[model samples]
Target: MQEHSHLDVGDADPPPGTARPGGRTARNREAVLDAALGLLAEHGYAATCVQDIATRSGVAASTIYRRWGNRDGVILDLAGTLVAEPVGALPDTGDLERDLTLLGRVILDVMSNPRDGVVQSTLVAAGVHSPTARRTLAQIINRRVEDTKIIAERAVERGDVPADTDAGKVINTLAAPIYHRWYILGEEPTDDELAGFARVAAHAARDALLT
Candidate 1:
């Protein structure tokens, strides 16, 4: 029988190199992170605990606490979960409207998927009090924003958008509603709704409304 015991994770920082340990240590780390992500997707943030992760991973609860310190460290350490990609990137379609619509669809897919949703939700949950979580999430968003710069630059070059239009602003505007509905309102929007928002952002950009 699995223990439904709540977490006993410490608030201290985990040991250095916890994710890169050697031999069986590495194996335990891998097992623990995998279990954490699976459980988080299945049960959500409030329902999951270190005991649950340990039971699922076949690792000891105490060992998990020692290695990760808390749920924050565990979720934030999950493999490739938070790895960022170039945001706002669409194939060169020679049309800003089409590119942004595609970008919005991509964001919608990520937020709507069960596994990906949980990974992001878990990060947001952990970011509340965890510096590591906050930093990691910020870094991922920053990278995405940086990557999207090319899209804005191209739009400027084509004169489809205002000169020196801010890429970060455009992507953020498009993403704001989707994220709000998902995380704040606890609702998943329809594909049409997601695409609509992206389309609106693109329209706004071309009309210089986002300026």
Candidate 2:
């Protein structure tokens, strides 16, 4: 898979409050992330540890620690990597409703993937107690927010939404309920239902409520 341009943070310990960065004393970043995901898949997040990932990836325990700070950080990074589509990558169909429906599809892709859902929910539940994980998750979210805002900006240009529409709120309004149903209600919505969500969000945007 192609790495995102935003992730090329060189081989340094990424600054806190930044996007996912490559880090290591050697070429072990991918190895470590792969091992972490495999172990997470097999044993779940709570049961997996940094040492297990170190052993599985054949990187040193100290290196993993210095690179990611903890197991939660590793899990968060993996979650970011697994997003099927970056918010910015969602296609612009020249219509707000259609664009948002496509956004719903992206959300559906993540919600339907067991691995992706587990990793996301795990971080949401566990990152609160870990500074590193929390910070990394924030960086991930900030990146997505920046990406999604572009959609709203385009909508504004087309007069589909008001110029002052808050893109973050618009996206949150569009995405929150779908994710709520997934993580909170333990429900998997059909494509039609997902499209409904997009329609609702589109209506709200057109009505200037999400501004």
Candidate 3:
């Protein structure tokens, strides 16, 4: 069975010298990405190749190479797309706990999708010894940190969190457990587990900010 998976708003174009599709090229490129994702899901990163992607995408192997330098390039492009357009924004329910719960749910929804397994695997592989993968992961991490900062700032404005709180730290504490479970322990958090983490994280952040 093909592994299930999951992109970006403006600036949808791939890097320069790659595929610049207008009509047919666009369609074909999209097909290629879709196929690549499917193969990644089914075969994992190491097993996937240009030939496999080409066959799945119905594009020529040369075309795949011309667009994406190699498998790593394609995977990096996919990761970039995933981060550029996150699934949703952080909740702003005014209640910090409630907001965290909602955010946890959103994260769980994304991670639990079978398609995301490919990403998870790719990231794990990259962690071992791929500078390119490291760079891509770092970009995503930085973006997420910025996003958490925004959430913390919003909380401060609403008087839900203290003004002196280090938003980055708070976010790290909240996110660390989930990532550890998924990437390190090989355990995927269920919705219930995510909610629990959210609760604990919210409470901890609140205490740090307010107390």
The per-residue C-alpha lDDT of model 2 at residue 147 equals 77
TM-score for each of the candidates: 0.76, 0.76, 0.80
- How do the residues 144-203 of candidate 2 rate in per-residue lDDT, one tens digit apiece? 666777777799999878888888877777788887888678888777887888888888
Tell me the RMSD of model 3 versus the true structure: 3.4
Name the top TM-score candidate.
Answer: 3
lDDT of 1 by residue, 106-199 (tens): 7767666665556776667777887777677677666766676566668889888999677788878787887788778988777688778878
Per-candidate clash tally: 0, 0, 2
For model 3 the TM-score comes to 0.80
What is the model-wide C-alpha lDDT for candidate 2? 0.71
* Root-mean-square deviation of every model: 6.2, 5.3, 3.4
Backbone clashes in model 3: 2
Q: Evaluate model 3: give its lDDT.
A: 0.70
